[model samples]
Target: RRKAGWVKERLDWFEQMSQLAVDREYVSGETFLYLGRQYRLKIVYGSKRSPVKLRGKFFEVNLSQSMPEQDRREAVRRAMWRWYRAHAWEKIRKIVEHYSARLGIEPPEFRIKYQAKRWGSCSQGSVLNINLRIIMAPLSQIEYVVAHELCHLKYKDHSAAFWDLLRLVMPNYEVRKENLRRSGWQYLL
Candidate 1:
């Protein structure tokens, strides 16, 4: 009975949170996330070759002025994806390097890809695959995911030993994990 009450409360909270980011259309004035900060989208008429640039507090996307309204939205979306993927790799690479040294393991090869349901995963072969969207999350959350995966190099499964190692490195990992869970919807875009 206690478990059922907790589940009901969690479900209600999710329902309320989902209403926060209902706008999926990539248009000017709509907000996007980067490193846990919100940046408003700014569509501009300019070169299609260089589509996206993060300037100050806005993600400015360049598209042809003559393009139809529908196409402009898509162009902005694609530009944002490209920019995010590039930045994710750059940031994650450095984080992995930093944590790998602290953990006493060589930085394993890593890739940033679009993952619909996972923040990160470590394979038996020691490769780290990070979701590109996770780049939108705060740096602490990203560090937690990287450290968690790197720890898997020592322990393949989520056994007690594995968690002990993770806790040793990231003392406040549980707090970061809960924050990620509560704010995940904001990063869906």
Candidate 2:
């Protein structure tokens, strides 16, 4: 009877703690909501307290305390997208110029936008369209995407030659590509 009572008491305590955790709101100022137990603001993770600043090379996350009335977390996410558009364009342009010269091909027009399923795309006209969300990724991942698209200028399809070209520029292209795929969804939220 004593052991049973102890188990029941422990179960009740656990339930109460779980409910408290669920009710806790991690709102910070007016721009961000700190999700998860820990508080951190990186290019990949969005939070209410994240400083409205861009990190190294790639990755921009919004840290705002006000404006949108929606979930504070969503507001921070939207701000991150805006930051990406405003800042990432120039960096991408420079990368395209560098790769185009190396490949000896006319540089294609580049555009960045919010894309759902793709990190980047190359049209028949050789115009390269990259997802602005990539601005939230690591710089190496961004470079991998750029190199992948640039290779398309040589081979329209993902042929063996295409992989070879990508490898020539980025020896660890495969690893970076996998990382991008695995963590890309973190930016979406």
Say which candidate scores most in TM-score. Answer: 1
lDDT of 1 at 58: 94
TM-score between candidate 1 and the true structure: 0.91
> When superposed on Cα atoms, how far off is each prediction in RMSD?
2.0, 12.2
Error of 2 at 22 (Å): 15
Tens digit of lDDT per residue, candidate 2, span 140-176? 7788888889999889999999999888878899999
Tens digit per residue, CA lDDT, model 1, 103-170:
99899999898887788999878999999989999999999889999999999999999989999989
Steric collisions counted per model: 0, 7
Q: Where does the lowest 10-residue lDDT sum fall in candidate 2?
A: 29-38
Candidate 2 achieves a global lDDT of 0.66
* Model 2 pairs in collision: 30-65, 30-66, 31-64, 31-65, 31-66, 32-48, 33-48
